[model samples]
Target: MDKRGSRRKSAARKDGASRAAADEPQSRVKFWMRRLVIWGGALAVLVALFVGLAVVFAARSMPGYYQLKATQTAQTIVVRARDGTEIVELGPSYGKWLTSDEIPQVMKDAMISVEDRRYYSHFGIDPYGLVRAVYTAATGDRRVSATSTITQQLARNVFLNNNRSLDRKLREAVLAMALEAKFSKEQILELYLNKVYFGGGAYGVDSASRKFFSHPATELSTAEAAIIAGLVKAPSRYSPTADVNAAVGRASVVLRLMKEQGRIPADATVDPSAVKLKEEAGQNSVRYFTDWALPQLDLLLPETFEPIEVWTTLDVGMQRAATASIKSNTPDGAQGALVSMDRDGAVLALIGGTDYIQTNYNRATDARRQPGSSWKLFVYLAALEAGYTPDDRVVDTPVSINGWSPRNSSGRNVGEIDLRTAFAYSINTVAAQLGNEVGFGTVASMARRFGITTEINTYPSMVLGTNEVRLIDMTRAFAAVSAGGNSVEPYGILKVETTDGDLLYEHERNTRSTQLVPDYVAAGITDLLQTAVATGTGRAADIGRPVAGKTGTTSSNKDGYFVGFSSGITTGVWMGRDDNVRVGGLQGGTAPARAFAAYMRYAVKDRPVEQFDTDLQLPEWQLEPDDEYMLGDPEDYYFIDEQGNLIEPGTSDAPREDPFGDEFDRTLEGDRPRQPVPGQRPPQQPQQPPQPQQPPRGVDGAPQAIGDDFLNEATGARRDQRP
Candidate 1:
């Protein structure tokens, strides 16, 4: 009886333990569920508070309504080349603003169908589209359609910034709501059409229509309206001026969308293959020229912001040629600028650099660099005006002014050379001598008279072109020499006119302009310039035509220049580094001269070939009898001994005896008597009496009288004298 009672008690204890274990697990699970519910509610409240604060912050930063309604773009400029071909359109262009009633119905329909399907139905934001976009984004799929309607786009374009952030989006949404409240749906559509950007610098529907189709917006057909509407999504991609085929395809997409929305007929279709785009010159390097000319327009029409057409003097063909030549010839790691103009100062082609897109600095008109030897134009002009002819004798020996010695580029000078030969070889000593003789002040004055508006230092080195002058100024000076001696102020803008054909200003010829250079002086300078190109330092610039230009290389080859003219067109080229670093082997005669030749060849291909007037009657010189300077190699004669005796050819110590034979030995003629040959000696000749030195012959070949100061004491050669 005791054993049975113990077993029943133990079984009851086990049953109690199992039931307790099961109930403990259920209790723990209930506790965790309660904690999860409490935390989730707290997180939901925090998110709501954060969103409320963000929306409040965005609403306060919105732009004013008055500012939104005002014109966004103040002005537009249409730059046209010389032949009426539009080069580029700068700044956003806003054409005639059309009201809701003036906008074509098809254009409105197309825009509405493509941009916002529920435009008339929605207040400002499309709730259905917004919901769809949010749902699609939540599902991890982007590429969702735009949720904002036409009102939203206009609000963003006119007032709000394009920052892709929550704050910007919220601000855009609030602005859209305000715009919809202030303007009706029709008015909103009109403002959107007129304010949105259609690429190629067009800002409004009318401007885009005129830019792409060359017609007004009201005249747009269904296809044209579709094309214009398609540009709203991606203006640069669909612009006809950029890519016509892509624009046509986009138009087809717009038409399909319009038909689906029941705005157009169900069977309505447009052929992409039949689309014809207006022909426009590709936006090219002409932008550099327009950039330079645009500022001048401001000076001519100050305080004016009206839409205007700028008629420039740029020759499209010549500009293209100049751009190509500069690009191909400019050395690596170097920059170049070019300016070409007619005799009357009409700028034909102005290239700021090799690639304008890479850099927009207008070196041609802006950079003031040392003109180098090309500045000798004034020094030589001063010489000619001082009554010194090209044939005047000047020795190319070493020269110094106040202890500053100028050396020739060759390091060896040819003594007793005429001015013509000295100028041809760019002999530095002669140029320095002439500049000093004529007075540096006179040279500077001559430079100013020829239109070098820069400050001219009357220092000795200034005559060698140390003064910094712009390429355009130097080219202008050359143009004065080429234009029959009248100075010209370089002008690029021919006229400024309103878009409606009202002329604001036109470049007028100054009939009362005085001659800066005398006719005879100009003709005389031409004689020297022609000889320089024919057989001198500027040989690389000769293009089988008469080209009279000068080459300039500054100290250490830092700057190289070639400026010349052909067929009444004067062009100047400059090559250098903006950082002022020296180029290894750059010289004016190398790249600059070649580039000049290349451009001139094409620029004057069709123009009539003309020659420079070089018929100036220059004074001639008769050679006075003197000991002839041997002009051949010393190796042609037998060697000499150390004791000053000639050695026979076959002797052992003959050929190797004297490295330089007696030909170069500097000794008096009578002191160093002539040696007889080893074989047979020629018969003796009678000595003639000394002849008196005759006066230099004038242009008429008559003996011209001169003063004692004009004669070189050593050579008895008459030097140039001031008149």
Candidate 2:
């Protein structure tokens, strides 16, 4: 019985132990559950702390982070020529920022329908839009349905780079909320419009309006407004200038959205044809002038200041005429440049090359080519300084210098010509000779003082333009002559302002003095250059105005140039190949002169007619007798060699008496010298027979005979007996 009872107890105890083991497993499960709960609660708290910190930091820092309020660097200033013709439109002023109130109602509604339908209701984050965005992203369908409020876009543009990151997203969201709190909805819209970048280097709506349409933002039409609104999302992709089709498509979307949102009547059929866009007549085509002016501005102002309004002297009328002339008259493969400047050194008009769109090479400011005979202006100046008058006779004769023989273009010697006629005819031989006689160094110095910075070769041939010169330099030099010999440096920007409309810097005309040529000498040269246009090779450039100019045709007829000036403005034109290839039959009188004439015809159409300031009195002594009639004695004039060596009268092969004289003495006999044979030296002249011996002569101190041998030795040769 006891054994049975003990076995029972053992069985009972085993059952109890089993029950305890089951309970222990249950307790372990309960403990694990409690620990999990604690851990989850702690993680939740940490996450909440992190999110709070991120929001606080972003709100406080993001607004000011990259909000760079660059000073107002440009102002809307009107550029006009001396004749008061509008030439160039300048920067934006009066705060280009536009609020929703400032924009057309249609534009505002279009923005809302396309950008964020629930923008007014969202508290900086749109859950519905987020879900849509996620679905699109996952499905690989690029449907941009995500809603970014105006505040968010401004935040992104101002403070964030375009990187897709969770941190950036969170910061953007937090900053959006912060901005909503700090600024009104209208203010946010204004900032967004002003801060967003438009295409074509434009940073704001104002720039876009002016650059694309040559109008103000306030003047945008429905089509124009729609196009501009469409650009806000993807400027480069929808820029009217870069991709007009894409812009039109995007604008259609905006118009459709506008209609759907009841901003426009649903029944209102918007004319698709009304969206026909015309690029501002001269937009994107004036790069040459801008390029020419920018560098000059850099030199005119401090490194930090870029002016808001640059009151340039560019005359839009003249520029248009010049461009039209080049387009209409210039042949294929022909390139050209035109520059016009006022007498005060202000640039009035400029066309750097034929096509700024097809090429970026600015011929007016960048190209350096030989000036050819156009360079004789400096030669004339040097001659005037050397007491040689334009009336002074210069003989166009066959001449050689260091083995180089310069000939007239006509290839016939024009005997006993005056300086004026020599210049008028562009006589190469006479020019080379004059350059040689007046000292090539002197001519080069005059060119340098007149504002030519390029190195000019000192060789006498340079007087006929063997050196290369830029149109800008030539224009400036001519302006100096127009300004009574005072050096005038070309300038573009008059002042620079900060983005906030504060004056940062200003430019004033600066002059330097050096004896380049006497004022009267420059005037005299100008007078002769005037005659070049009036009745010489430059006659093609005559515009019925008192014009002064010089034509240039380089070797091989490769380059053509015409640089001229009216009483108030100076212009320079050049035509040549960019590749440096010879252009077969082109001369200065063809394309370049025509271009100048065309530009001047339009430029001066409205101006009160004026003459060159002849009253700017030069000395009478500076005036040379007009070479129209040869009145001076041939002996009184001198001819210059290629080395600028002044050869005395009756020295060179130039005919002293008229070779075609009426005396008619063709049959007159003259002595002739023996000619040498082709292959052998003249048969050693037969040894002269011994001459008869002469008697001795006595010296002052003693009797001494001076024999013929002694005389021969003293003279280095025996006297010729045959007379």
Candidate 3:
């Protein structure tokens, strides 16, 4: 009985230990579950805090939606003629602002199709599109790329610059979301449509329709709408009037996208990007004037400028006449430029080229071409200022300055002519001799006094117009002469004001005019230039009334110019080949003079005929042997030589008696002459090149030297010459 009881106790103990082992595993599982719950909850709280901070920071960093008030009141620059006639309205002046409902459904469909097909389906941000953009960027595929949605583009156009950066992208995304929250879907679409720009100065869908189809946006066909929609990326590149083929090709891309997005029916297509037009389009005259005046805006207004009215000095009639005259008077394959200004320096009309839409290269303001004999006006003016007059006589014989001798257009000198006669004839030898006498420095100073701002090289050839100048600047100088010696600055904008009549800026009429050329000197030059128009090379520019002008023809007839003026107006005309090719000896007396005369006839017909202020007559002198002054060598100045080394006076490079000192100094006795050997052809000393012979020493024992003028080419100002 005792053995059986002991065996039962052993079995009971083993069963109890097995039960405890199973329970321990369950407890371990429960502890792990509790720990995981605590840690995951903590992580969730941290993530929530991070996102909240980012949202708060982003909201604080960006401007509020209410701050975008500029977009609503934005007006374009409306340029008007001096007579208050409208030439062009530059910005959003093409069409009236329209609501989203006023826009055609097809127009909206085309924009959404080409710009953002998934605009309605996504929230403010599209993650799938962003991911695809990133993938495309990574794969270096440039063709299939996505950047901004319509909302983001709206934000950029309204409030931000189109700068590419990670920070800007983040800000754009945040602002887009904010815009969506503040406005309804229809309102956002309205803003986008009203703010987008189409080429040819058309802004918004309504204006774009009128620009392309010459009708309201409410009546757009699928083809017309698609063509306008394709211009959002680059308005100038695909403007229909500028390039029809390009516009049609880009419209095809939009049509295909519209079909793919199911915005339009599969069969509905812009097969040919054709539309009905209501008017003859492409206003080149307005474009030419606006392009000339665009850069002046920054100096006239602040960078954060309000849209304002720019009342310019342009005359609509004169502008049209100028363009017509230039095109008609010029040759078939040549180009022309013209600028006209009143006596007070107001730009009455300006035409840079025959067709501005075809090319915006402004020849009047930007082209730097040689002025030829037209520059002789300054050389004569300088002589008059130095006591020489129109009656003064110069021997127009063969002349050369250094090695550059200029020949007359006639290729022969008319010997011994008065200053007025020489000027009227455009005699090269007489002009060069006078330039050498009075010095190039004085001539350059006179040129500057007349309002030339370009660098002036004072080489004697400069009197023959080796220096380059712009047509506008040359007109400004002539206006100064016409204004009785008052210094004039060429100006286009007469006044700038807000559309509501608030004065932003106005050109003040300061009666205190600065005098550049003296009245007497101006009168003298006017007398000579008047003779030029009456009986000289510029005779082609002669109007019925009294007129003064100068004709300019560059080497080989690459460029031709005729600048003429009357009592109240000064005009300049330039005709040339774009590639600088020589044309049929196209002298200034030919096409340029004809254009100048034609424009001037219309420019002055409205005003009464009057002579220039010629009350002040000047005394004349004669160039005599006893009193004649000549110029010395140019190597006296430390000018850069062909080797790029400074050729200075008293240096070995300059011809001198002895570059290095002799073996015996002045303090020691001079060496006796060496005797030659009796036989073998008398030993010879090395032949020394001829040295610069100084004039007979003066009474003060210094060598007498002729005076030569040197000028600084960088400043267009004159400097005193070394004796």
Candidate 4:
């Protein structure tokens, strides 16, 4: 019996051991599973904390919902020329801020069909679309669509820049949720449709409609609405302006989507080939002026949500004339720019290039080419301010400062001549001598006082205009001279006002009347400039009016310039290759001066002819053979060689190769051809290569002592106080 009981106990123990072995495995499994669940919960809590911190950090600086809504409303800037002609509309132009009732149902259905099919049902964010996008992305689907609802897109367009990043996405989502909470479904849809970008700088459905169809958004047909709706995906790529075929294709896809969603009938279809696009007017070069004016507008009203109307100083007639002059007169394979302003610094007309479509580079305001002899105005003005008059005698011999020597353009220096003759002839040696005597620092300071904003290196070559300068800044200086020595700040924007006619900013014309150059000094420069235009290098610029102007030509004929003033209008023109390569036979006195004359004829036709304000009667001087020791080599004085390389005293007639070979050729940028009309050259030199002419010496310069009567009659001011 004991043996049987022990065997039963062993059997029971074995059965229990087998059951425990199975249970042991199950217990280990349960312990590991419990640990995994706890760890996962902790990880999830940590992740939640991290995400919460991120959200708090991002939301801390966000604008309040009301402020955001107010600031995000679509605002457009309508830029008008001085005479109230519409130039261009900057920023996203909206149409009347249409209400829900004013919006067309066909447009609404098209937008909802393409952008967000469930836009009405979703609460700012679409979970189903998000899941579908994620699933498709996971499955490597190439056609993965954005998960953002219409509200989210609206939030992004209004409040955020279109940069793809997690932070931006988060901000977009949070803003979208807030927008949904604050605005009703209809209001959100209205804002979305009104503020969405539709390509070619158009912002709203209405702007897109008017821009593409020449009709209001309220008149959009099913086909036009589909075409516009399709632009939302890739506006620039599928804009009708970019590719009509692609736009039609995208519209077909949108129509298919609408049909599949039961928004349109299955049989509803439009023939793509039958579509008619609006014929837009040929865009003009006024965009350059508008472009330059917009930045100034920002300074006047940096932050505003209200629509603005900017009255600019641009004159449409003058602008057209300036463009035509630059195009017809600028040599083939060269580009030109022009800037015209009145004495009060109101920019009347500005052409940044001959054709803005061919190249958008604003040479008038942006390019910093060597001003050539136009810069001499500053040097001579500085000299005049330093107790030198236009009648003062200066030797026009070759000048060497340190190792740099400047020779005259004519390659021959006349004997001692008065400052007026030197200026009218653009005698380089006298200018170099004057700059050194007055000190280049003083010269540069004088330039600053006259509104030259570019960096002026006080080097010897600077006197020769080797330093680069912008055309607008140079033109402003000339304008100051025309304004009777008053300083000028070139302004294109005259006033800024809300569309409701409330003025925000108006330029004070009186503020810029402060005297920058002394009246006596201004008269002296004007006398010289008038002499220059009357019988000097700028003779081509004479328009049978009382004009004071100067011509400028750089080395290798790479740049040509003419800046002058007639009546109260000051205009500057520049022509050159973008690459700074030598333009064969190009000269400031030829193409540039002619262009200036051509434009000024039109610009000043209606304006009254006015004389310059002068108070100094300059005494004429004539140089007689005093047999002064001649300076410079006699042989080098005969003629200017082919290339402008220095003619060393005893060098052969064969042109000396430049030590800086090919360096001058690579000075400027760009590879595309300049705005040049083929088979066209300088108007005057259409057949013959331009020849250097000795500047006319016909003006009275006989050093005759000015009688008090003549001085009193010619200049109303006292002769003793004259510069």
Candidate that scores best on lDDT: 4
The digit string of per-residue lDDT tens for model 3 on 1-723 reads 789989898888898888889888998988888888989898999975874565556556655544543345434787888988777777654477777778888888899888888888765677788898888888998876556888888877776665577887887887777666666677778778877888777778888888778788888888888898899987877877766778889899999998998888889745645566445544666566677776587777754336778889899889888999998988767789999998887888888888775665678888888888888888888887787766555677998789978888888876656677788878888889889889999999888888788999888899998899988988888788888778888888888888789987788775777887667888888888888888778889987899898999989888898998985899999998888888776889889999988988899998988967755554433332111011122233233454544344646545433211353233122212232212112223344333344433445776433212222222333333333
**Judged by lDDT against the true structure, how good is candidate 1?**
0.79
TM-scores for every predicted model: 0.54, 0.51, 0.59, 0.58
- Candidate 2: tens digits of C-alpha lDDT, residues 156-212: 777665567788778788778777666666566666666666655576676677777
Worst 10 residues of 2 by lDDT: 664-673
Q: How many residue pairs clash in all the candidates, one count each?
A: 0, 16, 0, 6
List residue ranges in candidate 1 displaced over 4 A.
1-68, 93-283, 617-723
Lowest lDDT block of 10, candidate 3: 624-633
lDDT of 1 by residue, 126-166 (tens): 88999999999999897787787898888777766555889
Q: Stretches of candidate 3 above 4 Å error?
A: 1-74, 93-157, 160-198, 204-280, 302-307, 615-723
For model 4, residues 190-266, the per-residue Cα lDDT tens digits are: 87887788976777778888888898888888899999999999875687865777888999988888899988888
Model 4: residues >4 Å from true position, as ranges?
1-72, 89-157, 160-199, 204-281, 617-723
Best by TM-score: 3
